[model samples]
Target: MSSEDFPAAVPIPVLATQPVVLASGSQTRLSLLRGAGLEVVAHRPGVDEEEVKLSCKAGGLTVEETAEALAELKASRVAAKVPAAYVIGADQMLECEGRWFDKPEDRAGAAEQLRALSGRTHRLVTTAVLFHNNSRVWHQTDQAKLTMRTLSDDFIERYLDAAGDAVLTSVGGYQLEALGAQLFTRVAGDHFTILGLPLLPLLGFLRVRGVLPS
Candidate 1:
C-alpha cells in the first residue's frame, strides 16, 4: 500500500522495559507490529512446520490446539536465547470443513487451493504466544471465517496471472488486505486475525505486562 493508505501514526513507545522480538520472518506480521507502534525485532525461527502439522495430526490435536502449540514452540525457541526479551511466536491454520490448508508451494498449488476454496467458507485459526524470562507468559487464538465467492476458472487464471507469486504468501492462497479481497464474499472476525496474528489481544497482554501504556 502507499503511505497514504496507512492510518495516522500513534506515538511509538520509547520505554518498553524489555525488547520485543518476533519469532517469524513474515513481513506482514512485522508490519502489523511496527504499524501498532511497537519497536520489534523479527527473527525467522527454525520451525519445520510441515513436520509439526504431521505430528499434530497423528497426535489427534484439534485445529486450535495445533496452532497454539506451534506458536508456543516458536516463542519458546526464540525465548530460550533471548531470556530477557519478550519473544513472540505466531502461527496460522486454515481449515475448510474438516480439511486443513497450507501455504501453496507453487503456482499450480495456488490454483489448486483457490479451486478448493471456491464458494466455501474456511476458518483461519491464528494464534500468538508470548514468552519472557524463559517462560511462556501469555497466548491467544482467534478464528476468522471467510467465505470465498464462487470463482470462475477464467477469473482464477487471470487472478493468478495478475497477482503473480504474491498469492503464495499465506494459507488458502489469499491475502485479504490485497487483491485477494476480491475472492471473498464474506469475512467475519477481526481483520488482524485473518492476517495471521491475534494482534489486539497480544497488545493487551503487553499492556498488562507494562510493556506498553495501559
Candidate 2:
C-alpha cells in the first residue's frame, strides 16, 4: 500500500536533527514507517536471532518477552553504532498451543507448518523497541490471533504451489497480507501488527516523546 493510503492519524512535527534508523532489513517495516511519514534509514542489525531465542527459551521467557528481547537486542546493536540517531528494531514470533514456530527452511517445511496449524488458532507476537543515545527509550509488544481453516492435503499442495517461496519468509509460514490470507478463517488483531510492526502504538510512543506532534 502507498503511504497516502495509511496517513498518520496524529500530526507529525518536522524532525529537527537525525533521521530515524530502522534496525531491520524487512521491507514491510520500512514501508510501514515511511508510510507513517517518517524519514527512515534501513540498517540490518546483524543479530544472532536463533541464539537469542535459544537463550530466552533457556531463561524461561514467554514468547512476548523473547520477541521484545530480540527487538531490544537489534535496537541496541544498531544504537551503539549510531548513538545520535533514533533506532527502531522489531521481531515477531509465532506460537500455537505451547509450541513455538520458526520460519520454514523450504517448501516442504512450510507445508508441514501449515498442516500443523490447520484448524488451529495461533498467536503472532510482534515487538518493537526504540533506542536513542544507546539506551532503550520505548518498546511495545502486540499479539495477533489467527485461525487457519481446516485444510486438506490437496489444498496444502496447491497453496504451497501458488505461494512459492513466499511462505518461507514468515515465522508462521504465511503472510496474511498476501495470498496467505486465504489460509486463515479469522484474524483478530491490528493489520500492521500482523505485518510485523505495531505501527499505531509505535507512532503513539513517538508522539509522546515529541518525535511527532501530539
Candidate 3:
C-alpha cells in the first residue's frame, strides 16, 4: 500500500520537518513504516547480531529482553552516524518452550525448525527502539502467540519445497503474511507485531513525541 492510502494513525506535523531513518535491512519493516505515511531512510546498522544474542543468552536475559537489547544496539549504532535523525531499530525472536530460535541458515535448517514447531505454540516477540540525537529515547515490545497445526512429514517436505528460500528469512520458519499463514491454526496478536515491528505502539510514541501531527 502507498503512504497516501495508509495515513498514520496519528499524523505528526513535525514529521515533515525532521528526518527519520530505519536502522536495518528489512524490506518488510521499511515497507511498513512507509505504508504508514512516514518518510524514512533505510540504513544497515551492521551490528553483530549473533554475538549479541549469545551474550544476552549467557547473561540470562529473557527472550523479550534480548530482542529489545538487539533493537537498541541496532538503533544506537545507526543513531551515531545520523545524529540529527530519528533512528528506528527493530528485532524479533521466536520462542517455543523456553528455547529461542534464530533465522535458519539454510533450507535444511528451516525444515528442522518447522518440524520442531509443528503441533506446538510459539511466541513471536518483536521489539522496536528509537534513538534521537544520539540518545535512546523510546522502546516498545509486542508479542504474538501462534499455534501451528500438526504436520505430516510429507506435508513438511512439500511445504518447504513450495516456500523455498523464503522460509529461512524468519526465525519461525514462516511468514504469517504469506504462504506461512497455512501453517498456523491460531494467531493472537497485532498483525504488525507478528510481522516483526510493533507499529501501533511505535506510531503512538511518535505522535506523543510530536513526530507525527498530534
Candidate 4:
C-alpha cells in the first residue's frame, strides 16, 4: 500500500506502558501490528505446533476448539515470564471436509493441495489470544471460507514456478493477498482474519484493556 492510502495520519500513542509482545515469529503478523500503529515486541515461543494439534484431535476437539487451544498454549507458555505485559498468540487451521490440512511440504505437496481444493470450498479457522500475568484475558476465533476457482494443471504448475518455496509456508499453498488471490473464486470473511489475525477484534481487546488509547 502507498502513503496516499492513509492520507489521514494515524495518531501514534505516546504513553509509558509495557510493549505488546507477540508470541509467534510471523512476519505477516508483525507487519499487521505495525500497520495498525501499535508498538510490538515479537517473541517466538518455541512450542511444538504439530503436537498441540495432534493432542486436540486426540481429544476430539472441534476445529475452533483446536485452534483456540493452540493459541492459549502458546500465550500461556510465554505469559509465565511477562507478568503484567500483554502477549498475543495466534493459530490458524485449514479444514476441508473432516480433514485438517497443513502447509505444503514441497512443490509436489502444493500441487496435491491445489488438486484437492480445486472447485471446492474450505475453511480457515484462526484464533487469537491475549495473555497477561499468566492469565487468559481475551481471545477470539474467526472462520473464513474460500472457494477455489477450478484450477488447471497448467495454471497450478505456473503458479508453483512463480511462487516457488513460499507456497510451502501456508496451508493450501496460497496467500489470499498475493498471487494466491488468483486461486480463489470467492472468499467470505475479513481479509485480516483470513491472513491469520482478526485485527479489529484483537485491537478492540487492547483498547478495552487500556493497552491502546480508547
**Candidate 2 stretches greater than 4 Å from native:** 1-18
For candidate 3, the 10 contiguous residues with the lowest summed lDDT are: 10-19
lDDT by candidate, in order shown: 0.91, 0.90, 0.90, 0.89
Query: How badly does each model clash, as a count of residue pairs?
Result: 0, 0, 5, 0
What local lDDT does model 3 show for residue 189? 94
| The candidate that achieves the highest TM-score relative to the unseen native structure | 1
Q: Write the per-residue lDDT of candidate 3 for residues 134-179, one digit (tens) a residue.
A: 9999999999999999988898889898988898888878888989
lDDT leader: 1
Candidate 4, residue 166: how far the Cα is off, in Å: 1.4
Better of 1 and 3 by TM-score: 1
Clash pairs (backbone) in predicted model 1 = none
| Candidate 1 residue-wise lDDT, 1-214, digit = tens | 7989988887765545556999999999998888886889998889999999999999999999999999999999988888999999999999998999999999999999999999999999999999999998899989989999999999999999989889888888888898999999899999999898998898888999988887
Poorest lDDT segment (10 consecutive residues) of candidate 4: 9-18
TM-score (C-alpha, index-matched) for candidate 2: 0.90
In angstroms, the error of model 1 at 162 is: 0.8
